[model samples]
Target: MSAIMSGAISMGILAWIWANLSAAVGVSTWAGFMGTTTYYASGERFIKGWVKGMIANMVGVLWAIICVEVSKVLHVPNIVAIMTGVISFGIVAEAKWKNLSFVPGVYIGCSTTFGMLALNGTYLSTVVALLMGSVVGLLSDAGGELLVRLTNKKETEENLVEKQG
Candidate 1:
């Protein structure tokens, strides 16, 4: 199978498994999906991508929380909007750090935080779901590579047998 096909299959299988497990565990499946996507989008190796995505996501969540708190404390007109702008700037500024350079991850994390809040979900649960998703991403990637290797080996063996025949 082609690499793309292998990767897609791997991801599809893992996603299905995660969705069922997450639903049973009361975790946010959506958050986990986002985490998996973010891991792939980072385009780094498994460990590096996971670490960068998690860091960026945490920064985003922190900024989002601060934005909400500051808006509440100030109680000024359009304070939420103002705080959002500040947080947005902060999120971008965080990209200066090598470990947090995945800007999209930061944005996704911030949006996920807001989404969780809107759904009356807890941040801790969201974090857990995201972590699970990242793990799934890693597994899916490994599975895809393994599948490709196995397929290649089988093809080589068949070619050798045909030549001998």
Candidate 2:
């Protein structure tokens, strides 16, 4: 099967088993798509981008949950949630981190935060769902990597057989 298909299958099974995991499913799907595209570019680049994207999604979701939880504890107005999310993004953007250079980490944080808040999800559940999503994305990437390797091996074997026969 194709790498994208592998990722979809992995995430699909996760979503089917756990309804809450759907929160991260959209990001996971994109990660799978990006992974497949990167693989076409080069195997090394695929692995690097896939890992970085998954990590960024996890960090972003965590940061967003933190902001939302803080706002809830402080009894702040709903507007504060937006401010908190944007500020969190700024902090992440300015921070000195190698992985931050790739992936839309800030956007991920902002969107996840706002989306969860808009949905009126509790702090704990929101965090749990988002974390699960990130893990699923990572798993999907690994599946994609395995598919690529298997495909390459199969092609090599076919080429050898053709040359011999």
Best by lDDT: 1
Clashing pairs in 2: none
How large is the C-alpha RMSD of every model relative to the true structure?
1.1, 6.4
lDDT, residue 71, model 1: 81
How would you encode candidate 1's per-residue C-alpha lDDT over 39-106 as one tens digit per residue? 88888857887888788778777777888778879979999889989888888887788887788998
TM-score per prediction, in order, is: 0.95, 0.53
Candidate 1, backbone clash total: 0
Q: Give me the displacement of residue 154 in model 1, in angstroms.
A: 0.8
lDDT of 1: 0.85
Question: Residue-pair clashes per candidate, as listed?
Answer: 0, 0
Can you give the lDDT of residue 136 in candidate 2?
50
lDDT of 2 by residue, 1-165 (tens): 666786677656654644443433533333223323323222233346445654554565566666656666776567575767566666567557775544354345445556666766444444444455445545555766677778779989999999999
How high is the lDDT of residue 113 in model 2? 51
Give the runs in model 2 whose Cα sits over 4 Å from its true position.
1-89, 97-103
TM-score of 2: 0.53
